[model samples]
Target: MDEQTFWELVDRTGPDPANLERLADELSDHAAADIRDFADHLARALHALDTPAHYHAVATSGASFLGVRCAAVAAGNRAYRKVLGAPAALATYTGSPGDQLLPVAERAYRTSTRADWQHQTAVSTHTGSNVAAWGTSWLHPHMGTTTVEGLAPQDYMIALRHVALTLDADPAWRSWWRQSGLTACELGIVAEGRLDHLRPSADIRRCADRLRANFTCASPHGGADLSARAVSEVRSMFEVIRQAMSMPGLPPTPPVPTLPADVPEVPVTAKPLAAMPAELEPQGYLTLTQIQEFFG
Candidate 1:
């Protein structure tokens, strides 16, 4: 499925989150994989050179014939379930119409009945900028010898699609994902959890920080450039987030090297690593500056 079809699928549903569970079926001929690949196209297209990138971009990014907010929620939820635990805690938080999600922690309480979910209570702000700025891990569950540097855009799409399909398989997760405001908050959860105990790559955190810092939607030149950058980085970061999260449907990614308990922090001025640990040396994680820089 291409970008146009993806939006067309979403446009038929309008903005109601309630209609999402059945949304994938709307693309009748498409498989779960197609729905996910469509999400990749939609994400890239929404933040295209012509489109604007805003927090609300998912809701209002496209023109009248196509608004992508609901589609983004579907794609994001599909990706979300593959995260570290896909937390049972997250499942408890059913979204609603008038959710007070600002302080994040407050929203967590209102969304979930469980008390143990406090770890994720802060939502996106759960990890302050300083923490992510310090260091991040580029690791995956069940080491398939995966590293963020070696990933392709399709690889990210596959992982996210896996999550979407996984959630689709479970009626409960899909039900909550279809609720109002859950998709947005869930994306926020994915973003905030980047630095959680899952051991995200410091490179991802740095990139995310830079993306937020450089974002300026008001200025013409600034917004255009920022939109372009957001497009690239969001794709890259989702893959990074996938690496940080769990992979469900794909093959096992090879493990990189054993990382130290305290992963070293990358300096802003420093280039990607020139070398990698012996285990990763044979892979481009050693030879390629792009792969080695972030995960080494």
Candidate 2:
């Protein structure tokens, strides 16, 4: 089945094991590879969202090292689309950004012109300057004292350059980045160090990578095309991971709400009083003030 159809079936079926098993069997032996691929994709995602190795990486490599090199992937996507006036993005961001920022960013990444996970790139260009710094700032408040020990000044510089290069496109973002922390000189040195490939003593990346691979929990998300059963099984595994880590489980996908049969269609008053003819259309909409003239 098509991805949308598969998702719709999943939504309507509510992940009943029977439903999943039936779906799985329907695929037949020919589809076993698809099942395994889909399952692995989910298993990997479970590993990334929580798990001990994820934190190990967080402690050494920083949040960016966990996924595709940035925790703000979700936020960047939303902020970029919100800035661009994307129809779907605007609809979702109607309320205050508040805690919903991450989901917004995720959706933005899924829907924006750069729908392929180039979130920081979009956020960098859209907001202008240091997308990394901006993204890192968002992570800072939540990171607590878990600093990446021995984070090589060189790797750090490379990360900073990723952000600093946006300067030519957006000086304002850089101005904002500098305000996040460190004096201008400090930021300058970081930039210079990045240019010079300097290091304080050692680095954190290798350690983090080692721990990341060493952890048996799972791995980062992989492969896009997934069967519904694979999604279900993956999410189920995610539950296991969540329980193990004492992290909150993934929220259950709610079935889309439908209009009740008893509910009337839109009332006449909601529409215009009359449809203007072709010639009369040029007169324009008759506002309340203009319509009042008739009564007078």
Candidate 3:
């Protein structure tokens, strides 16, 4: 359905699940294409609210923030506009009141004998940055586009270690990190590793040593155990960092040499490399130079 009609339906439904069955029935009458259009409009509305200011105003980030935005849209067009005008209005959306909208299209589709829902949008709205001019700004007004390279290795680790410990202590914060798909600590570790790999530095090694020592002392036990969620996230983060490092303007991947055909061929046993320390693992990381160029 068109954006105006879709929102009119939402206002009639009154942001409550009680109106869902009736709403689904109404939507069932429309062409199946409109069902997908409803989803696209909903996605755009939700994405519009995915701003740092909105997140800051609601005192939440990630999926919880998305839920609050959903609640705003479920509040209907006028209420959603109110929120866009004043982000602090989001403070009122404490519950998952808008969750009903999430499944409305699917329910409508299931009840009808029409074709399956097809996405007509150019970009997938499931994830990624909001596609609005007022969306996320790369430059922080107070920080004024500071680059990661500005901080010394030791100074950065001290700050990162503090945050890592904080994340370790609070399950909620860790859960948020899990949703974000990477912890600040994980990024810091990867950044340090990738930079050191490109150019070895004694300072980075010393900082890593100090960080491990501090981590040991922070917990009553030797160190906090990494959760399975964190382990999986870190593994993915590492691959992402490695790929980023191989991007344009950074180092190019070396070509593998071809071996000449010889009279005898031998199968070589590869030597196992020593395991990286949990805190110092160099899997996924960002480069300071890359950040410098980006922020500049």
C-alpha lDDT of all candidate models, in order: 0.29, 0.26, 0.46
Give lDDT tens digits, candidate 1, residues 1-296. 66556556655644355655345335434554454455455434322211111111221212211222212323333332332123232222223221111222222332333333223211122111222321221111110113223222222322332232222223343343233222211121111111121332222222331211111011112223433333343335444434543422322222211221222221121122245578763222222223223223
The order by descending lDDT is: 3, 1, 2
What tens digits encode model 2's per-residue C-alpha lDDT throughout 29-99?
Answer: 32333333333332222232322122222222212222211121223333422433332232232222222
lDDT of candidate 3? 0.46
Pick the winner on TM-score between candidates 2 and 3. Answer: 3
Candidates 1 and 2, the one with greater TM-score: 1
lDDT of 3 by residue, 7-46 (tens): 9888998877688788899988887778778877877787
Total clashing residue pairs per candidate?
17, 3, 4
What is the Cα-based TM-score of model 3? 0.49
Who wins the lDDT comparison?
Answer: 3
Q: Please report, as a residue range, the 10-residue window in candidate 3 with the lowest summed lDDT.
A: 211-220
* Winner by TM-score: 3
TM-score of 2: 0.19
